[model samples]
Target chain A: MIRTLPCSAAYTNGFRLYMVLFYIFLIMPLVTICILAFNDSNYIALPWNGFSLDWFFANTNERLGLFKDEGLMLSVWTSLETGFFVALFSTIIGTIAALLFEEEQFRMKGFLYFLALAPLVIPGVVLGISILLSSTYAGTYLEENLGMSFEFLGPSFWLVVIGQFSFGATYVMLLVGARLKKFDRVLEEAALSLRATRLEVIWLITIPFLRPAIIGAFIVAFLISFSNFNTTIFLVGSDPTLPVDLYSRIKFSSTPVLNAVSFMIVVFISFAAMISYVINRKKT
Target chain B: MKKNKSSTFFLLMVPVLLWLVLLIVIPHLDMFFRSFRFENDEGLMVFSLNNYLSFFEDKIYWLTFVKTALYSIGVTILAFIVTFPVAFFLTKVVAKKYSSFMVLLLLIPIWIGELVTIYGWMILLSDNGVINNFLMQIGLIDSPIVMLYTNFSMTIGLLYMSMLFMIIPMMSALESLDDSLIEAASDLGASKWTIFRQIIIPYTTPGIASGGIIVFMLVIGDYVAPNILGGKSSLWFTEQIYNKFLATFNWNEGAAFGFLLLLLSSGIIWLALKLTGQKLEKVGS
Candidate 1:
């Protein structure tokens, strides 16, 4: 559309310059961080001494590399573990939600749909704290009245998973629901008319058709759960997830190890993205 | 078959009902109720307006609240302005084959997460950081500029993290736009600015609204960028809520602040939707 616009040479040049600067602004900082991961300096930033792999490999007194940093490693593990469970739960629940919403005669569909998507609008901090507050209240009430302690209600591993999952499922629902909308109901009706059970039809036909979206939603939910901070911080206990751990460290003091971690994440995400992009292109 | 249909409906309903009731409904209602109660001298919980009242009475609280809203709105506008042209260029100016690749580049930062991006900005903006070091090497200045821990840096952090969201929606909107409309208008002697204002803007309003809402909500609720990048005086309202909950252990006040944040942000979004004549359902989708 812009190609059709009647514009002066100056206007075209100005737009080109603006785009150059915009891409620079977008890519420069990330490139800088990755470069600094190999910096020999003690600081996270530059004044580049010669390159060294100390951040990634060293385990000396002062230079503790990310590989050897037990605390950070544990946090990363916690995040992966949490991401797995959150993704699992959110995919199951959210797929069910997508299927439920697709039902033509469902009761109060509009209201229920809104309820499902409500987590998206609510701020993460608000969600985290509200869940934290209510769970604590429930925990205290139960302990006082029924003499049963619910450790999961308090800030703990499971609470963090639950907190992240609250919003994660919403995303999954939207993703899967979009794909579900394009599904041909005629195929299902044909299978049903031939005396196939509803369960068998859903399993053999519907699930297979929705496979791409289900896989995509699962990966997306995992990524969201892993990188989430605002909500996770409030619900995390002594065992902090990677983002929470990174937050406290960045706030108080930071080292080049952080750059190492960032560099690895960049590589991982870019690899995953390219693979998906290739797969998607092939599908088309 | 009738029993199977009912059972299937019930089977699906169980998980959705459990999730909505346990996670969404009860928690928020409990927080709302907690916000209204306070402990008296007898250490017993009683109803009071103290939490909400204190928000008005306290200068810093209400001031921070207003500042957060204004800054978030400013960032949203800035994000839109900065990304619109990029979106336009990608969708229209650039060749179709390469534009998708360009968009993939855009998605990398978003997938890399906020902490990594914030850390990247810190490396750029900090004293003795890359920019300053390069400047000093060229004999530009004697002293390093105090760019980090300032409102400028904080705003940059916020904008950098969120601008991609704006571009994506705008691109999708612009993608669906018919090119001949613009060509016809131009051929009919419509000025470029007039064509843009009359044709492009009206067509892309839905995308702009959705993107604006997202960026606004993100900036307003953001804790990492403000705390990590902003100076002491650049206290965001989320920080106030954080202090109330974790720092001071004042859950009631924190809950009140939380609700206020939710209400104010939602109210602003609602007004924007009203003014734009977009429905919540459509914008939300």
Candidate 2:
């Protein structure tokens, strides 16, 4: 569909130039940070003093690398732990929601679907606050009324997972639901006609068909939880997630090592995204 | 058999519905009421509209609230303008094979995370940042200019941070458009500008509306870009809510502000949707 319109060559040239400049505008910052990660300078800023991996592996006073930094590493551990749990729970619950919507006779489907997506539009800060307040209120009520105490809701690790899952699940639902919409109903019916149980039909035919979307949803949920700061900051207990830790650290005492961490994360996520892209392309 | 099917359906829906009701809806309802309740000077709980009143009475709070709203709206429009052409070029101008790769370039920044992306912007726009340094090296300026911590920097950060949200929707909208319509218009001897305004713009209204909603909401809700990129001068509404909750420990006030922020963003989005004749259900999808 190349344009056969009476467009001038100058217009095409200008459009190409604009595209190149826009790409630079979009990418220059990340590229700069990546390049600066290896800078040998003590400052986080410029004057790139030759490429050095000191920021990543250096273990000494004033310049401990990301891996060696105890607090930072702990935050990284907590984030990974939270991300895993969040992804697992969100995928299971979200997949169920998608499947539920697939039923033609499902009651209140429209309203329930909207309710499912409510969290997606809510601000992360508000979501975090509401969840924290409600959980703490519930925790106190249990302690006073039921004479039992629960530590899980009071700025604990599980709170972070729950807070993240509240919204992350919506993402999973959308992804799986989108895939489910295009699925053929005949396969499920054919399997059922062959005396396959509902569970068996879903296990063999439906699950296999939805594998790519389910896996993709899991990865997306994991990444969202991993990088989420706006919501997670409030829900985080004494152990901050990687983004929270990086945020506070960047605010007070930023080092080149943070850039290194960013570089590594970018690489990891880019790899994940590329794999998903390939999978999706292959599916079609 | 019908009963069994309904039961299975119920079983499948119960967990997700319970999750949404217990975690999402109930908490929000609880917070909405909590916002109306304030603690008195005697340290006793009292229900009043004082928290919301205080938001209106305080000049800084109300002014900052308005400014944040304007900035968010401004960013949304700016982002739409900046990315519309790019999206059009990618979806319509570029060869189909190369467009996906072009879009992939946009995803890299997003994958890098907001904090890291803002950090990149900080390095690029700070006093001794790459931009200033480059300018100095070229003898364009005598010394570094303070680009960071300004409203300009904040807008740039917000625009860059949420560019993908705007781009993805617009690209999808534009891609779904029938190229034959454009060909027909051109063959009818209509100019490119006229075809774009009359044919293309009307078609992508829903996409534009959805993009505006996402970008405005995300920008207004964002704390990282404003805190880091806008620096000390930044008085983002989210930061105010944060301070009320964390620093002041005024949960009631924080809750009120939180709800206010939520309502303000949602109200604007609702109005925009109404004006554009788009539906909420369509916007979310």
Candidate 3:
């Protein structure tokens, strides 16, 4: 019956308590690991094992030098490279796909739209395995027909990038399509009436209008690609992505070093989120 | 009026058609064809239901399917329990200024990737981890409780990852409701609980349904959470499928497993749509 606070101060107190509890449950794990990154103990236990920066600087096998470890660093860099490439490929292709969807005359528009989103709906693990199989088969076919062996095409970096795109592009299309759904045709008409070319109008008007959504789609696709474990798992070659590395380590024997990496990720991602939020706030 | 516009439409439609053909439709056809084509002793060749037959005959395959389905439902319910109050408080109860902070706080969990969240939980649940030491300090127990790798740990990880997915849709739905209805109910001398049951709950029914469906679909399709948090002891279907295709060199059986997953995922999507959706009926004035 309460539209307002119901003049109940105790109710507000209880509500605040409940909200605090939810926040605690939601955030405690994240905060704890982050805090413990500075703990001096090799173990992940509590009771405060004396605070130090060694977790960040520790060069041991199982502690904080995960940041310094060459193999792990290479994997991190590989994932970053893959993420950038995937985001670049997917966002451009996907934005074009969104533009295409706005065209009214496509006979199979309904079916095509569903098909574009199918990758997203499929499990990442399934998509990964399927791409690997299909790509390997195609690679073999090409090798026989052309008399050229394409090692990279079979199961490699560019393949991982393209494999991720087989679906990652769909997400970009969906996000951009959402904003484009409310697109006013009148603006394009007005630009045309002003003697603006289609390209000019697109660059000046449509691009500006779609900027926020485009940025959002790009960032999301990047995050998803970088953090992706399922699809990347099958396509992973000698050089693994960060998630693949983390998954392998987690599978065999996890050390506190993985915790250090997670701690760094928390810091970096939160900083990025905060910056985006501020920029968005200022824009509005 | 739109005669020449068809040309514009054609020009625009080319890219999406090409994308669908090259990426999605072709691979799906490949998957279907590969399902029937069992890898023989002679190498990759023609078609049969031998792969599918093997899928049904194996107890391990069937058991994994059951476990995955059960985990999906469990995570959905747990997410529902965890997300409702936070969303409800944000939309209906909290002060306007403070609710923004609360919403932003929820973003912290989501902003960190699911892998990070799982690892974070792992540290806390480790034998010598946070909880164990805290318990020992409080004189609660002598031995550290080994909590990770259990089904309970896996469920917690899934719930954490999926809670935001549930919250966002539900909040959107709840925010769309007219506040005046609750006010009207209050004016009629209704209690807060009664008003909630009669008005707010019914109004947001679609929201809850859609939110639950969204969570259910995502949870079922997920293999990551279980893999990272489930430890080696648990045998999840996607893990098995991954091993078959990548590690074991059995592409045919893997395709069969993939097809089965595709079937189950699609069926869940259909059921969700059926339950939460209704075609708009022409209402009489």
Candidate 4:
């Protein structure tokens, strides 16, 4: 519709130029990193000295590929573990919250809805720090008064999971809630009238209808937890997630192995995103 | 039946209540209280305003706070300026079939996460990075320009990671706009600039406001870009909080700084909302 709007030739040409440059600005850095991942140079930067697969497959005293890097591999495993738990918990809880919000008879609906969405507005760093402080306080109090050590409350794997879940669930709620809004309630009523129990109605009918959103929300939650840095950095203890590990390594000294890590992440996430995109398109 | 309904409601409410109270509400409230107290020399915690007072007494803390707030606002505005046209082009100019593909391209970088993108920028902006190498090869400059670990690189990094947030919302808003309105305005003898300023701007205010709020919050709270891409001179407020927590091990001071940051960023966002006449709930959704 807007393509037909009458405009000067200069205006059209200028807009085209801007669009081209904007995309370049957006995509160039990513492409640069992906290209430099195979560079045979010792440094992570440019002036590439011929191409090699050293970053990915080679392992020696000087150049260690991603496959053989123990610390990097452990962090990757830790991230995957954290992402899985965070995604699972957030999807279940967020789906329930979505259902609750959809209930017309729910009390304090507006205020409760606001509270549910509050995590989205809060800054990640603030959330991370506040959780850290409160959990430390709680841990100290428990150990002092009750002689019980709550290791989960401190900076540990579970702490990272909880911290990420704090906001991860909000995302799932929003995603699932949007889908729930478009649902046909008449189908639920029909199943209920046909003598199906409420539990069975939800399980057999509603869950199937919401399957796409639930899957999408789970993936989104996993990605959120996997890539999280600000919040996870505070809550991560001895073992760090991939992002935290990458951050420390990059901050101290960056090798192309880091580029190898980024290359793998880009490939994995892009594949996941494409699969989800295809699923969504097919459903719609 | 009534009992079943209430029980189901109760069941659903339990997790939501636990999550909000245990994770969101209580932690923030605890941090709020912790911000007001300090540990004295006797190894005892006491109620005092020293935590808050120290922020005022220390020039670097407040200065960094101000700088972070200002830079975030600047970046937010820059994001809007840089992405608004792209959003407009995608929604209005591009063929419908290709627009989603373009959006997918945009989402790819964002999904790749900030750390990777920052690493990408580091590769592009470093002294011997791609940009410098190209410039030197082209004989544009005799020596490599120190783009990394500076304010320029930091802003570019911040803008790169966050511009998508601005674009996504604006695209949604622009997608809903009727092309007939613009056509009518143009037919009514309105100049291109006038139509854009009067018609298009007013129509997309909500998107602009929401995107601005998000971009501002993200840029201000960002620690990675500033710490890595920014030089020693470019000290962000989040870094101050991180230093208090990890470096000095002052949870009290860190808590105080954390609250101040929350208050400062939220206050700015609130003010921006009020000025733009956008409600928190409306923009948040």
The TM-score of the first chain in every model comes to 0.96, 0.93, 0.90, 0.94
**Runs of candidate 3 exceeding 4 Å displacement:** A1-11, A44-48, A60-64, A194-200, B4-11, B40-44, B191-194, B231-233, B278-285
Each model's iRMS: 1.4, 1.7, 4.7, 1.5
Which residues of candidate 4, in runs, are more than 4 Å off?
A: A195-197, A277-284, B1-5
What is the per-residue lDDT of model 3 for residues A166-219, given as tens digits with 9 covering 90 to 100?
Answer: 887888987887888788989989998999866677668877888888888888
TM-score of each: 0.97, 0.96, 0.92, 0.97
Instruction: Rank candidates by TM-score, best first.
Output: 1, 4, 2, 3
**lDDT of each residue in B1-285, candidate 3, tens digit only:** 355654445555666677678667766677767889875788868678998888779888888988888778777888887788778888877777676666777777776777788888877777777778789989999998778788777888788887787787678778888788778778888887897788877787677666776677667766777776677666678877887876887888888888888788767766765765721110000
Best first by lDDT, ranked: 1, 4, 2, 3
Give candidate 2 regions above 4 Å deviation.
A1-6, A277-284, B1-5
CA lDDT of every candidate: 0.90, 0.87, 0.76, 0.89
lDDT of 2 by residue, A16-42 (tens): 898999999988888888899889888
Please tell me what DockQ candidate 3 reaches: 0.45
TM-score of 2: 0.96
Give the true-contact fraction for every prediction, in order.
0.66, 0.57, 0.46, 0.71
Candidate 4 CAPRI assessment class: medium
After best superposition, candidate 2 residue A125: deviation in angstroms? Answer: 0.9
Tell me the lDDT of candidate 1.
0.90
Ten-residue segment with the worst summed lDDT in candidate 1 chain A?
A1-10
Model number 2 iRMSD = 1.7
Error of 4 at B78 (Å): 0.5
